[model samples]
Target: MLRTYKFRIEPTKEQREKINETLMYCRWLYNALLEQRITAYKRCGVSLTFYSQKKELPTLKKVCEEYKSVHSQVLQNVVERLDKTYQAFFRRLKQGEK
Candidate 1:
């Protein structure tokens, strides 16, 4: 047996602004990471794994101050999501689902 619950509430104006900012940062990071992986593969014939990307977080934070504001767990989740997407895409390709 299992149960689930969901709740929604109106956020304050500042909270809304902060939420938007966080989303913007996450979107930027996702795109940047994707680009990095693509470029690495195209130039070096290598695939960047999640762990390798995750290890760069500290350096990224140092280079981009805005990223520091976003929680580490949230940043890691973004990487994890991208990795999962890549895995699923490859899996489908392997199955010859063109």
Candidate 2:
């Protein structure tokens, strides 16, 4: 079973803008990487491992920081989940599955 939680924060216009900007950039990077991985696997039956995909993170972190500046750590927190997700995907793939 799983659970969900919800919370709210009051952000100023500038802070809201920064958060949105950071999240958008994070989403773009995550999706592009996923798409690239998918394309690679389609071209070759063997899936590219997350262990390899992670080499891009330092660069991705730079993108996150460049847009939002002070909020980089918060943005990095979200992207980190994508990292773990990719790791799980590779583990499943190696086990002969999705």
Candidate 3:
């Protein structure tokens, strides 16, 4: 059996601001990772794997202050989301869907 539920949250102004900031961080991380992957592939025909990127999180945090504000799990999930998207895209390509 399976079940699902949807709920709404009413956060305080401060919480709202934090939520917005997290979303912005997520957007930035996604764009940066995509660009890095594209550049890597173009430069040497190498695609970065999720684990490789995940392992760089500490170094990335040290280099980018904004990343420090977000939770580690949140950032990891962002990387995972991109990986899943790429996986789906390649799977579609193999199926001649694009």
Score every model by TM-score: 0.92, 0.55, 0.90
Over 4 Å off in model 2, which ranges?
1-8, 60-98
Which residue ranges in model 1 land beyond 4 Å of their true spot? 1-6
- For lDDT, candidate 1 versus 3, the one ahead is 1
Instruction: Estimate every model's Cα lDDT from 0 to 1.
Output: 0.95, 0.68, 0.94
- lDDT digits (tens) for residues 1-98 of candidate 1: 89999999899999999999999999999999999999999999999999999999989989989988899999999999999989999999999986
| Candidate 3, position 53, lDDT | 88
lDDT tens digits, residues 34-53, model 3?
99899999999999999988
Better of 2 and 3 by TM-score: 3
What does the lDDT come to for candidate 1?
Answer: 0.95
* Candidate 2, 1-98: lDDT as tens digits: 89999989899999889778767776776687678777987988766554565565666667655643535455455456666887887699999995
Give the number of the best model, judged by lDDT: 1
